[model samples]
Target chain A: MGISMENGLSTNKSVGKQSVLFQNPPCVLGYSSIAGKKEGEGPLGSCFDIIEEDPLAGGKSWEDAESRLQKKAAELAIQKASLQPKDIRYLIAGDLLGQLIATSFGIVDLEIPMFGVYGACSTMGESISIAAMLIDGGFADKVIALTSSHFAGAEKQFRFPLDYGNQRPLAATWTVTGSGAVILGSPKEVKKLPEDTNPTIHITGITTGKVMDYGIKDSMNMGACMAPAAADVIFHNLSDFDRKPDYYDKIITGDLGYVGADILKDIMKEKGYDISKNHMDCGVEIFSKETQDTHSGGSGCGCSAITLTGYVFKKMIQREWKKVLFVPTGALLSTVSFNEGNSVPGIAHGVVIEIME
Target chain B: MGISMENGLSTNKSVGKQSVLFQNPPCVLGYSSIAGKKEGEGPLGSCFDIIEEDPLAGGKSWEDAESRLQKKAAELAIQKASLQPKDIRYLIAGDLLGQLIATSFGIVDLEIPMFGVYGACSTMGESISIAAMLIDGGFADKVIALTSSHFAGAEKQFRFPLDYGNQRPLAATWTVTGSGAVILGSPKEVKKLPEDTNPTIHITGITTGKVMDYGIKDSMNMGACMAPAAADVIFHNLSDFDRKPDYYDKIITGDLGYVGADILKDIMKEKGYDISKNHMDCGVEIFSKETQDTHSGGSGCGCSAITLTGYVFKKMIQREWKKVLFVPTGALLSTVSFNEGNSVPGIAHGVVIEIME
Candidate 1:
C-alpha cells in the first residue's frame, strides 16, 4: 500500500469505493463484553467479561439496565487497556433507541468527548470504523468504540410490551441484552502485551455501507430487510480491495442469523465471489437453537458486538484466525416509520481486522 | 498552527484539552437550508434557500416531510457546490428522531456512504465536527454535514401530540421545521467562484463537548438544561486556544433561547470571562418574541443549523462577521428517561469558522 504524501499528510487513504485503507492501522488495545442472563447461558457465555444475572441489571428499567451494561463494558475495557477515561480522546457510541437514550445515559459518567452514531444493530461497526479513522488520521491517540442493546427495551420500543405477551414469528430474532466496548489506539500508543503469546489485532481498513432499501416492509423479518445491505457492503469490500474470498480466514457478518446468512452467501455468489466457505455469522454462533429457542438467532447491536469482543477477539488472540472481515448489518426502522407504512431499510459497515505481522 | 510531522503525517492536531486545531483547515464550499412555512415566516426566512409552504412537503406524514426536507437540502447543497451526489465521499447526517429514521430514509437516495449521528439539537455541530475532521485528517476529500427537525414530529415524539392541543409552558421553545446541509471539502478541492469575491470560510478548529448533567429534569425548560453545556464548551475552546471571547467576532450558540442565553452569560462571567458584549443566540435571532408568540424562542436541530447555513454564512460572505465560534447545544433526553425521573443531560460542540487569509 503506497501512501501518496504531500507536505505532512497522506493524500490517498480512500480506496476504490466505499472503503478506506488506513496507512497507519489502529490497533485494538483492549476490549470488554457484558452480557445478560440469557446471553450468559448461551454457547459463548463464558467468553463474556461480565455477566449480569438480573434482567434489569440491578436497575429499575430495562433502558437503565442497558445503560449500566454500557458503563460496565466501557470501564472494563479502559481497565483492560490500563488507561483511564481521561486518557481517551474521543468516544464513539450509539444504540438502537429513540434518540439514543441508552448511550446518552450510559457513557455520561466517562466524561469523554463523544460522537453519537446510529446504524441500528450495525452501530458497533460504525463506532469502530470512526474510532479507527480518527486514530489513523492523527486526530486522536486513543478512542473508545462502544455500543449496547437490551432485549426488553428493544421489544418495548420496536414491538409490543412485555405485558402484551405477543408471539414472535419464526423469522423474528431475539435482541441480545449486552454491551461491547473496544479501546483502539494508534500503533505507537498501544503497549505490547508480553504475557500474551499470540498477536496484536489491528484495524487495517473499513468499508462503510450506504442505506440499501429493498422495500422490505416486514419489521419482524429484519434479516430479510438487512440481507441486501449486508451483501452490498460485503461485495463492495471484496471488489474495492480486489481480494478473493479465500484471502480472509473468516468473513463474519454481525447478526445475519440462519436466514440472512444464506441470503448473503447467495448474493455474494451471484456477484461472482463465493464467501460461503469462510462465511460466519455471530447470530448463529452465539446460541443453541434447540435449547435457547432463538429462532432466527440473536440480533441487536450487541449481537455482533459481544460476539466480536468476547468470542472472536479471544479466538484471534489465540491465533485461530489470522485475518477477518467483520461486517455488522443493521435494519433501520422505528415504530413511527413502520407504523407509517414505511419500508425497513438496512445498512452495514465492514471492518477489516488482521493480526500484526 | 505549526504542524509537527512524523513520516508525512501530522501528529499534533490535538490541542490543550477537548479541542483539535487542524493544520490543514477544511473549507466550506457550499450550503443549503430548507424551511417549512412557519420557519419561512420567521426573521431569517428570506435567507433560506427554499421554503415549502405545504406542511407535508408533498409527503404524507411529518416524518416523510422531514426526510424530504433533508433530501432537498442535500441535493441543493451538492448542486451549489457544483458537484453531484457521487462527488461527495461521505454524508454525515442525523435528526431528532428515533433510530434516525428520517436520516436513514432521507439521504438513502443520495447513495453516499453515510454516518448517522445524534446530539439532539446539537447534531449540526456534531455532524460538521466529524465532517471537518474527516477532510482535515485526509479520510475524505468532500463530505456533507446534514441535519433536520420537524415541529409536528418533534411535538409528538417529545412533548405532546399536536392533536392534543397541549398547553406549553412559558419557558418552552418552539421546534423549528427546517433542514440545513453544508458541503465541506479539502481546501484544494473547493473551487473558487470568480463571479463573487469574499474571503472563503474555513473550519479552522473544533472543541467537542462532553455530556453535562446538572440534574435538571424539566424537559419543558430545555434552555435551562442546555445552558451549562453551552458554557462549558465555550470556556474550553477559549482556554484550549488561549484566547479571550473577543478573539471571535461573535460567539454564536445554537438554540440557547433567551433563558439559556442569560444563564450561559452568567456562567461565563462566573468563569472569569464576560461574553455578553459579543454573544448571540440563534434561537433568539430566528424569531420575534413579541410577534411570533414563541414563549422562549425557537429550538431544534434545525434552528441552529438553518441559522448557520442560511443567515450566518450569508453574513460572513458579506464580510459582516469575520470569525465566529458556532456552538450548538443539545439537551439529551427521551420520553422514557424523562418519565423515569432521569435528568436531562446536555452536550455541545464548538466549531471555529474563520475567513481564510
Candidate 2:
C-alpha cells in the first residue's frame, strides 16, 4: 500500500557506509549537557559519582524549569557544535508537555530556525533521524535534534503519580530525568573525513505504524503498544531490501526493553520473517532492575537517545561494532484512551549506524 | 533573557477578512491521507469546520483523530499542489510527540522518501522553509510539510478543564484544530505556477530562534513568551540584512495575537526598528474568538501553520500582498513547567517569501 521496491521496503542500507564517514560521516560534532540530575555513574562510566547536582526541575517554577532545561541543553549543544546560536540552520526538538513548551521556549534563546516535533518517549530517535537526513539530503548545513521528559512531572500527566501506590506494568518505561542534544553537520571546514566514504548513521528509510489497539491495555506500559510499529519497519527493511537478519551485526530497537523486544520478534516471525540474530534493545539495558527497580525496564525518549549518542555510536567509532540498526519505538496511547478502554498502539523508525570503514 | 518585545499593549480588531476567493496555485502538488480525519476542507470545507468545534485542550487522544486529519490534509495538499504523492521526494513533519507520529503514521500509507522533523510549534514553518530552500537549492524535486492538532485530545494533557474555572492570562492563545500541509517543488514542473512567473515561495533566507526566558512567568500564555523572538528576527532582517519591513507587502508573525503583536512592535522600536505598517499575526486570525470564544487568541504549533497554508500564502499569490515575511511563533512551555510554574518562553523564525520577478 505504500512505497515498495522489490520485496517491499522503502529504505536503502546497502550503500557502503564506510565511505560516508569521510564526506558525510554523520559525526556528532558537538555534545553538551545542562543536566537536571545525573543518576548512573557521574560520567556515565563510574555509575556512582554525581557529576553535577543542579536542580532546575525542583526549585524553578514551571515556566522557569522549561526554560532552564532547554537553555542548558542548548548552551551545551551549541558550544559542542561550535556554531554561533544563530548559525544553526534548524532546531528539531520535542518535550513531554501539552504544547512542547520546553523545547520551543528554550529555542527562543538559541535564535536558530526550528521545527518542533513529537513522538512521545521515542522522540530522541525521531529527532536524530530527521536531523541526520537534513544534513545528508543537503537541506541544512547543521541541525540539532533533542527531546526530554521529567520523571516526577510527566508521571502525573502521562499516567500515574509517583506518589500513587498503583502497581507498575511490565512494559512501563522509566521516564528520563534529564535531556541530551547533539549537533549534526557536514564535514565542513574543521578537519577531514575519508573523502569518498559512504555515510554512517544516515536515515535511509522510514515506516510509521498505525496506532493499533489489541484491547488489552495498560497506561504505564508502552513497549507492547509500540511492538507492531517496530516489526513493520524491521520487516520492511529486510523484505524490501532483500537482506537477511545477519546483514548487519545488530538490529537494535530504541526503548523497547525486554518485553517489547520479544513481542516485536514474535510479531515479525509471525509474518514469516526472523529478526532474532544480533537483535538488541535499549530500554532493557539502561536500568538495573535489581538496583533501579524500573518495573519492566527503563523507558524514555532518552533511553535510546543517550545510549545511541553515548554508548552505541562511541562504541561503533571505537570499532567494537561495525553495523547496527537503531529503531526508536513509541507508544501512541494517551491517558484519555487508557481511561476510555482503548489499548495502546505502537510505531517505530529504524536507522543504520556503522563505523567509518 | 527570553524574547523581550512585550510592551503589554493590546491591539484587538474585529475586522473580517476581505471577501476573497480561495484558490490553489499550481506551483504546488501532491496529496496523501492519514487515519482519515484529513486536512483542509477536503474538497468540501466540512472537515476543518468540524475540528473547529469543541476543540481539544489537552490530555485527549490523537491516535484516532490525527489519523483522519493528517491523511486528508496530505491528500488535499498534494492535490491542491497538483502533484501526486508518489512523486514527492520527501515528507517532513513532527509535533509534540516522540515518534513525530502524525506525519509518520499518517505518511506510512503514502509512498515517498520521508524524513520526520520536530521543532515544537515552529514545526510547520521550519518544515516549509526547509522545503522551499531544498527546492531552490535543487536537492529535492518536491517536499511536503504536514502538521495537525486535536483540541479534546490536547486539552486533556496540557491544562485543567476548560470548565475548570481557571483564568487565562492576557497573553494566552488557543491552538488551531486543523492540520496544514504544503507541497513544494520546482515551478517548472507541471507548469503548476503561472507560466510567466516563478513561484512566489522561493525561500531566500531563514533565521532560527533560541531558548530564552528573561524570567517569563506564565507557561499558559505563549505569545508573551515568544514575541521577543519574532522581534529579534524582524529587527535582524532590518538591521542585519539592511532590509525594511516594507520590502514585503505584509509581514506575518505565525500566531502572536493582540498581546504578542503589540510586544513585537515595541521590541522593534526599542531596537530602532518598526514593522507596524503591515504586521499581522496568524494566531489571532486563524480562529475567531468572537465565534470560538477563545479568550486571548489562537496559539499552538499549528496555529501559524494553517494560517500560512490557508491564509497568508493565498493572499500573496492573489497580489493582495507580496513579498511576505513568515515568522511562525512558538511558545516553549510544556505541561511539566506549567506544573513547575515556569513562565512560557517563545521563539519565532523568519522566512522571506517572494516570487521571482
Candidate 3:
C-alpha cells in the first residue's frame, strides 16, 4: 500500500498578488547567487549528475557559504542603492531552512533590522512583492530582499546528511542551490510606480497552494509530483481577478522539472485558459540541457530566488518583458516522508511583478 | 572570577532630538501580545501558548510552539492594526531555531510579504528599532515586529536537550517564554524620529554586548550576564549626549533579570553617572514571585516584548511616563556554547519609546 498524508491536508492552489497600482519609485539595486560547489558551473540537467562531488565539501560549510551569500547580497543591494549600513531601515529576506534561521543570524552583524521571509522558491517574487508593498504602503524609506541555499545545507536538513548515501529517484526534483537579493525604495519626485514593470503586474489577486498529494506511484517525477498544485494556483489566479492567460505577459512557476511543466500546460488548456504566449517554469529553465539531465528543474528556495535575480530581474530591467506572474512551488516534505513511503505533497504561491517606466 | 567587557562599548547614546520632524504617512495601527495560552496556544509565555507544557515531557515540539508563536503574534498585531492580511507589507519576526525555521514557516500561510529578523533575545527590540527606522525613513506603509519564545523551546535550543540531565544553574536566566508583536507604519502625520516625538523619550543610546566570560556565569543569571553591556550603553548614551541622569524621566533595559539590573546600577554609579530615580527591566518586571519566581525577572525574547506591550506601552498611554529610553538586552550564547562549558556573553540594543501627546 502507498503511504498517504496522515494529516489528509487538502491539496489545493495558493497564490497571492497585490498590485502597487502605478508607482515604481524603486529600482532593482543589486543581485547575486551562490551555487554550492557540487552545483557545477552550469545547471545540472538530470538525475545522473546527482553523483557529482559535493561542491561545498572543500570550502566553508553550507552555513558559511550561505552566510557569505547573505553578506554579499546585502552589500551589493546597499552599494547599488548608494546607502550605508545604517541608511537602510530594514532587510527583508528568507529561505527554505524550514524557517530561514541561517539567513537571520548571518545578517545580524550587518547592523540593520532584518525581516526574514520564506516562500520556498517563490521567495524572489515574495520578497519583491513585499518590498513593493512596503514602498507603496509607505512603511519604509528603503528595503532589501534576499534569499540563498547551499547544497550541503539543504542536503543535511532536507534529504540526507551530507555524509549519507543517496539515490536519485525519477521524481527527486533539483533545488536551485543559490541566493538572490533586491533593494526597493521610493522615487523623490512622486513618480508613478514603474508601468513597464512586469505587465502592469499588480498582484491584484492570490491563491495559495495547499498540502496536496495525488498518490505519486513513484518518487522520480516531480513534474507529475507538483503539477496539481501548480495548476490549482494558475487556475485560481486567473479566476480570482476575473483574469485570463492574456492578462500577464508571461506566467511563471518555480522549478517543477520537465514533467510538471508539461502537466501545467495541459491543465491550463484543459481549464480553457491558454497562457501559450508566455508560460515558463524556473525548474525547466535552469536545466534546459539533456546533459544536465536533471529529470526535473532545480528545486528548493533558491530555485525561484536565483532565477528571478539572475534572469527575470535582468530581463525586466532591459524591458525584455513586462507584466509577469511569478509563482514558486515547493513540495513540502522531509526525507523521513519519502523514507516512510509518503508521496510528496506540493504547494505554490504567486506574486505579480510590474515595472512602471 | 569576574566579567570583563571591552571599553566604551555601552557608552552609546541617542541621536539628538530634532523637534517637528516630518511624520511618515503610515502609522502603527494595531498590536497585541500573548503571554499565556490562547485558543490554540503553543509553548507558554509566547502568544501561542497551546504547547506550554514541557516538550521533554511529551508536551509539544519546539517547532510547533515557535511557529505558532509567530503566527499568533502576527495575527494579533494585524488584528490590532485593523489591517487586512494583504494590507500588511511584511512580517518581520524570527527566533533561535536551527535556521529560525519556526518563524519562517509560521507566517507562510499569512500570505503577506515577509522580512524574517533574528537578534536572539534582542529580536524584540531589534525588530522595533528597525520598524521605527523603516517608518521614519519612509520605506514602507506598514511593518510588523513580532517575536516569541517558549520555555521548552529555549531549554532545548539554548541550555540542555529536553532529555539531557545536566544541572541547570541559578545564574542562568529563563527564556521569557512568550510572544509579542507591534506594528510600525508611515504615520499619516508622521512624528519626528526617535528623540523628536513630543514628550519623546528618544533612544538616547545603545551598546551591543560581546561574549564576556564573567567566570561566575551560566545561562540563568542573564541579567547579571548582560549587566556590563547595559552599563556600556548607559554610559555611551550619557557620553554621546553628554547628559546627566535627569536628561529624561526613565531608563529601562529589555530583559535583564533583577541581578543584572542591580549590577547595571552599580556599574553606572561607578562611572559617575547615576540613573537611580527611574530605571527598570523586563526580566524583573514581567513576573514576580507570585506569578512565578522566575528567579530574578523575566528573561528571553518575550520578557522585553511583553514588558513593553503590557507594561511600558500602557504606562505611556496613561501619561504617567515620558521621555523614556527602552533598552532590550540579549544574551548571544548558543546551545553549543553551553555544551562547550562556555560562559554566556550578552548584548542589549536600545530604542526610545514615548507618547506623542
For every prediction, compared with the true complex, DockQ reads 0.55, 0.20, 0.10
* Among all candidates shown, the one with the greatest DockQ: 1
TM-score of every candidate relative to the true structure: 0.97, 0.77, 0.68
What local lDDT score does residue B60 receive in model 3, on the 0 to 100 scale?
A: 43
Docking class of 1: medium
Local accuracy of candidate 3 as per-residue lDDT tens digits, B194-249:
32122222222223222233543466667776787677766655654556767667
Query: For model 3, what TM-score does chain A reach?
Result: 0.77
Best by lDDT: 1
Clashes of 3: 127
Clashes of each: 0, 116, 127
Residues A120-160 of candidate 2: C-alpha lDDT, one tens digit per residue = 66677667766665565444556777776555556666767
Report lDDT (Cα) of residue B216, candidate 3.
35
Which is the winner by DockQ between candidate 1 and candidate 3?
1
lDDT of 1 by residue, B2-103 (tens): 323222123488887788888889988788899888888989999998998998899999999999999999998888777888888889999999888879
Docking class of 3: incorrect
* Pick by lDDT: 1 or 2, better one: 1
lDDT of each: 0.89, 0.58, 0.58
